[model samples]
Target: MKEWSVLLLSLTAAAFVLFAGAGTASAADGGKILIAYFSRADENYQVGYVEKGNTQVLAEAVAEATGGELFRIETERPYPKEYRETTEVAKREQNEGARPKLKSTPPDIGFYDVIFLGYPNWWGDMPMAVYTFLESYGSGAFAGKRIIPFCTAAGSGLSGTVGTIGKLCPGATVNNAFTMLGAEAQEFSDGTRAKVREWLVGTGLVK
Candidate 1:
């Protein structure tokens, strides 16, 4: 009976070690998350008079859904407050391939394992400020991290921004991209959160 008891104890200890190892493995595989976005708050298309930028609203939704830290990418020189003026400036920047100086950057950028990059589609591409932010990180800065792109657009969806990001952040894993209409994001009360949640689930970022 004593020998049997010792045998049972040994088995129990082995099971506990196996279970603990499995839990540790799962934790190691689960990466830290960050939501970085460049958003505009003034005039926008489709949705009139919004206090928050369309991409900002969606980025907030993603942060809420995933419990990721939020980082706003700001430009050193603020863009024109008026929508039309902003569009012109954006167009000029894109045409010139100008990288506007970023006012702020992600905190401890290298610490985050998964980065959710959000921005508004400007003239069928991501805003120039976003490009500045990406370039600020330098080459191979996002080497081993996972990048998930999300965007808000009036009509043009994504506009090949995913490929652009892949090119910018060489060696980084760019996952599936999500694009939501500007109107949907602004009129969030009209099932915007639901759509964001659905996309998060689809991305396997949330249950």
Candidate 2:
């Protein structure tokens, strides 16, 4: 009986040490960055598909700045190709609180320590696909990771989407967000790059 108790005590001590070590690793040295973004590539508002989506451009910049892994949060069923049609559908989804099915997820999702979540502002909210990603692994999907939001919008800068993320990802360490105009992203690459770099540095995720 005494021997079993000693073994159990040793196991408990080992688990505590391991848990403490993981906590320290989470905030250490930009810790395994993951840049996850949802972008639409077809006919967009004002900016036609010149090759890439506005949010995609920002996602790439974030990956470059932080050496983060990129994960595109895509829908299994595609959205409408026309901008107006897509917006109409988006509105309905937002009203219904829809969770569209996703195409895929990162194989090593739990390995990421800092996640930079990017999306376009849709009806003052994130794409329904983004919610799918957040809820994919059940509750606490973003637990123990620092979540930094970046977004592109024509006018509605973030539109309180960051707060919505906090609601979705209950235990996530959600931080202040970065917002850029979609038109500016398409028209001014240099300026957008500078802004992305500045935001990454300000977040202390990149030097």
Best by lDDT: 1
lDDT on C-alpha atoms for all candidate structures: 0.83, 0.81
lDDT of 1 at 126: 91
TM-score of every candidate relative to the true structure: 0.84, 0.83
Summed backbone clashes in each candidate are 0, 0
lDDT (Cα, tens digit) per residue for candidate 1, span 1-207? 999999999999876543223222112454788889999988888776678999999888777667688999998898877899999999999999998888875487788888899999998889988888888786888999889999999889999899999999999999878998988888887376667766777666666
- Model 2 has an lDDT value of 0.81
User: Residue 116 of model 2: what lDDT?
Assistant: 88
**Clashing residue pairs for model 2:** none
Top candidate, metric TM-score: 1
